[model samples]
Target: MRNLASLLLLFLVLLAAGPLQAAPRRDFANQYQPRRTVEVDTRREGDSLRVYLRFPNRIAQRRRVPLRVMGWIDFDARRPLWQDTVRGAARRLRPDGDVDRLSFALPISRLVSGHALSVAFGDAEDAMGGDAAWLRLTPENLNRSFIFIDSLSRPLMRRYVRAREVFGVDAYAPGQTLNAYRYPLSSLAAAPPMATSNTLGQQPRTLGLQDSARFNADQLLRLPAGLYLLRLGNRGPSQGLLVEENRFPQLTSADELIAPLIYVSTSEERQKLFDAPDPKKAVDYFWLGVASDDQDKARQLIRQFYGRVVVANTIFSAHKAGWLTDRGMLYQILGAPETVYRSGNEERWVYRGYQSLNTIFVFRAKPSIFAPDNYELVRRPEHEFLWYAAVELWRKGLIAQPGR
Candidate 1:
């Protein structure tokens, strides 16, 4: 009986060792069968090409997969082909090397009147284990190409060319009777004309109101270059309108110009202004109606805010205006900091002990240094407003210091 019991225990040990010995071999096979997937999309500003490679959640005990991307451009055709290589343990294993996203910009000069754009992708050495998809460019598919308009003088044109059957086309000589596309305002349920009295008295004034009126393409084509505010109506649900100055140079063959105007709503506009890098003017505009009651106070506040912005500029001008820069804007709203630290590319701010508030601000200086100076702020997370809330609580004496 004792001998039988010992043999049984030995058998269990052998069973466990068998699978352990085979695990490494399976891992080796997976590493070699790397799988990949990719997608390509183009917007007016530029093209976004994404490649996603999936691998086993665990690779040699590490959570990350290594991927390398290589690409080439067909200058005349304005096309690009990108490829990827899966290396290291990932190459030896058949993890889910499925998807990777890689983005590249095509120069606007490369796009010509008759030329078509195309993109392709595959694994290193043209490996057959992954999937590849290409986006073809044609006059009817203008949206698939990136058309950048960096100047206010440039005409605002649609980035995409729909199916040729969807719209008609006409061509013209440059600087000679520029061709125009017409879109019926009634067809666009989103961009309704505005009727509000709110107008920015500035030279390039901004108008914001609500109204429901049909706008003709001629009106859109004739609008001078500058920001124009439009409101669809004040009665029912209001539709927002944003009319910028310019024409889209790439979609010249198009005769119909209609876009969804999804991002240009009034609320979106206000949110954009609030998140703007230098939002003082926007804030002033928000309170414009009340400025008449206490002009002195309003002026004082504006000066104080501007002063903060100047100080922020002096201290935070790594790449942009002090008030427009991340750290400068945070400092402006949060007032002064209780503690601050600088480390390589990051600036950290700490504000402690105010009611239920504790906060930290981190700014990346190097990246901002390379960004455009006139860039606007578009988003501010909830945590960023904590300092303002803390100040309010501190003033209300809801929070007490540890020592006191």
Candidate 2:
């Protein structure tokens, strides 16, 4: 009787411990899988506008996965806003789900003066989860503010101009009515058509102009050189007008206008920039930012940086490739470690500077078809640049070191 009781107690304890171990392992697996980041670019066509969302190859998998997209357009006060879903490509999840690429497109009619468009992605269903990421589309006459939504209804994640160094634009009409349009000349398929008025309102009739009277450059150029909304009237239905100035232009050159305003807003770019080179660029680009019009220069930068990442991978890669993993490449660029530790599948990289600003890069190794060893950087501390800046500041005697 005594032996039986002891055996039963041991079995129960083992059963309890089993889940404790398994739970963390499962959670770690999910947390480690790389989350996809999206990039959006818009251009105008004849009567329609084409919006393209580019996904990095690192985010796509081998199993069929659906991406849900949603969009909303607000034209004017008189007409109701337009809202609908825009489905994205059905991507396949790779065995590891760590490195895949995919993209989607949405098309709509020409945007009039006062219209604003918003778009986002839906949550993933299965083992993966999806969070809404959005882009707000504004006409050329309005301030070139790109609103990036990390969470809908929540405060904006980033609101700024596009990176002009990477994108270029040509403005036709200089000062008259600010007909300045900015597009990433390198990435755009072709020039988009220009529209005169806002056409997204629920009641298209609100714009008293004849349906056939499309807005021409002459009409658009005539408006006072300021930000204007292409809606109905400024007042009530009785006072139906064609155009109304709402926002002002931020700058003279549309490219200069939108550059700093729009940002990548994700650490993925930095991570990929580290791993993306065929043979990473030298440390030169890291110390020297990328040039605007030089692809060869960018490629050279990648090669240089990637070379060091390869070294880090050779020295640090445990179950995964060093350049492919977070800590490996980060440590390579960041130089010798101040401290290093691991929690489950995640390896944290700590760099101590003037202040205790620690940058954490969380990584996970997952099964994938591309390679036997796959790893991803899942999380990074916010405002990491400040830490690097702090380091520089300390070196320059601009700031005191921590615990000094």
Candidate 3:
């Protein structure tokens, strides 16, 4: 069971790096369908880390499986120091996929900046499809002054100017009747939106959960997805709060389909595609050229190669498309590493590459207000040499080459 937990942790780590739709797709709706996943939100409240697990109500709404999470806090030494668990019995939730949250504050007195915290949901021993994620404790994460949205809640995110950055919504409007404050903070008990505005684009309405009964900006739960500000005592925008859905992964697209070439393309080769009249065809030509003159071989290569792109899309997606990420690039170019080392706050992938040479890549787990699972690649000069050699093999229709 311990071995299984370790493997489960490793799988979740890699899965977190990419998008969650790693399975073979038969329809486009599957991509947009609510994902069966979990998101971790942390804030510093006094001496403990306020941890919130956010998910869609539909996740386990129909199943009898109990939802549970096991977690711990780690200090700067990069090791676990304490562990705790929270479980919720199966229950009904309204409006399928309407957001819901399970929150528990854990002790973090020993946790300073650079420490980490993690949580795993569901039973690992029973082969249940549990999910896990971790966060690196930092002031930016703990210090964000946010209004709690319970009785009206989900993942607690900050109010910002743009929804694109943090997986939330944008401003419904800019100018308002109320004056904006400068660095102001406020709280909400239960309130509704003010009267409708004369604004053309953003009409005033009661924005509830999923915008069902949206009230005013003061109401945390019924807040509409758009641009607004942190108002003081129900005044104007002091600081902008862009709100939108933060936890869901983005669906794949055509542009993302070709983004993986960053790792394989040389500076000159990549420019050719950009300079071409049709960049899409240019991408196809490059792959066909790499396949040497065989259409069948090119088809196989594209299928097998981009298939990895799909998986990478499902696995590495965070702030950007998965293929654009460092881990995604490596996975696309090198396949899965032979071994992966993971802790509460770090990851190391060891790949046995060509000639059985071990090419080791180290990634540091960097938690952000928007993404807790984001990891940064620690680049080394040796990586360039390794990357180019692998590209050369692919250029000759060898790497990730499908069998006849």
Candidate 4:
């Protein structure tokens, strides 16, 4: 039995170290997977952290399965530095149509400083089922000074504000003057540099300031569509926010609908779609072709594809729209990974592969002055075949639908 256990451990280590294929497995990193039970958002407020948990309304409305909320602070990813149970927090559910949200204020002032804070919610029976979030925390993160959209009631986890929504500034030290600046969204959409490759010290493209404003705690802000930065003063740390038209991450316009098709459409095909007089109709026609004139199949394909577009925008968005980012492209085409592992500055997404092999994609954190959650994919020559193959599977309606 001892020899058998040792061999099994060795096999597991080998699987993790290379591109070996295997069945879907569970890990401690469900935070990176598409959530099914709840969505978590956290922010720093002085010496305290504010956490918001949002779950499907049915979970509360049914009341069949008891729910639990738990959290902890950790220095290394392996062990908890501090842990807490939100006693009876699940009983206080504020319903909002399809979802319900609960808020908690965790005072971390007395606890030892930690690098990451995690909160998880789900079934009381299993103690874990809903969703979890692992947020990077520090002594002086930008969450100290951020804008709150007064007109929006949902969690501000995505840092997205609709154009023309009313917003108010919040700072650790109240009544301080805040400087807000806006910049045009960058126009580049290429695969990120590989792990083995170097950026050649290349800098992100320069963006010109489009607008600026001054405000205080008592002031209200409303801006046109662009990228906005909120800071304490001209030289303070800035919190990046995205101002989008329509409900963001949702495809409502022709441009939003057409942009995500780049992965599957040929150059000529994409140009025609863009040049078409009726873009919505063109998009529908394209999907219909992929579905082979089957209306139901076409509908399912469209729903799954664009559904991922919305989720990509929600979870992976940083400087640009999520569906346009490297991870976004992969998520849109391939759906969620079977397993996700994270470290200080990198993430590894593993998926079941063809034949007897498994596939792994690594993303390195490339935080910039403008986008803190920014990550670049470790691009490779071999990945081109995987990408094209997945695109073909999508076009052929052969890919499984769900968890998009």
Which candidate leads the pack in TM-score? 4
Per-residue alpha-carbon lDDT of candidate 3 for residues 1-404, written as tens digits (9 for 90 to 100)? 99999999999998988866643311111111225345555655556666666555545454456544333344222334544444443432233256545566656655566565555444542221123444556655565323333333444432332223423222224232222222211111111011122322352233222222222333323333443434323532233333333322332333443445655666687777777787778777888898887888888888778877666556555444455566776767777665555544667676664444666677787644333456777766566666666677777887642111
The lDDT, on a scale of 0 to 1, for candidate 1 is 0.33
Higher lDDT: candidate 1 or 4? 4
Across 160-218, the per-residue lDDT of candidate 2 in tens digits comes to 21222111121122222212321111111101111112421232222222222223222
Give each model a TM-score.
0.25, 0.26, 0.52, 0.78
> What is the C-alpha RMSD, rounded to one decimal, of candidate 3?
16.0
- Report every candidate's CA lDDT: 0.33, 0.33, 0.49, 0.67
Query: In model 1, how large is the Cα lDDT of residue 109?
Result: 42
Task: Say which prediction, candidate 1 or candidate 2, comes out ahead on TM-score.
Answer: 2
Q: Given candidate 2, what's the lDDT at residue 369?
A: 21
Candidate 4 Cα outliers beyond 4 Å, as residue runs: 1-38, 42-44, 58-76, 87-93, 108-114, 121-130, 139-143, 152-155, 172-174, 190-205, 235-237, 354-356, 400-404
RMSD (CA, Å), candidate 2 to true, equals 19.9
Query: lDDT tens string, model 4, 1-404?
Result: 99999999999999889987764332434454445535655556766676666655445455534344333343234445555566666576777778767777777663333366555554432342213544556433424545353645445555667788777665546677888789987545555323234543464567789889887754777878888777887776567777888878688988788878877777788888889999889999999999999999999899999998898888776677888788887778778876676666777777765423477888898776657767788777666656666777887876542232
lDDT of 4: 0.67
| Lowest-sum lDDT 10-residue window in model 1 | 24-33
Residues 15-113 of candidate 1: C-alpha lDDT, one tens digit per residue:
977755421110111111122213233433333322222222232234343343433332121123544444453434333233322334454444543
Q: Is candidate 2 or candidate 3 better by lDDT?
A: 3
Ranked candidates (TM-score, high to low): 4, 3, 2, 1
Looking at model 4, the pairs that clash are 20-358, 21-357, 21-358
Candidate order by lDDT, decreasing, is 4, 3, 2, 1
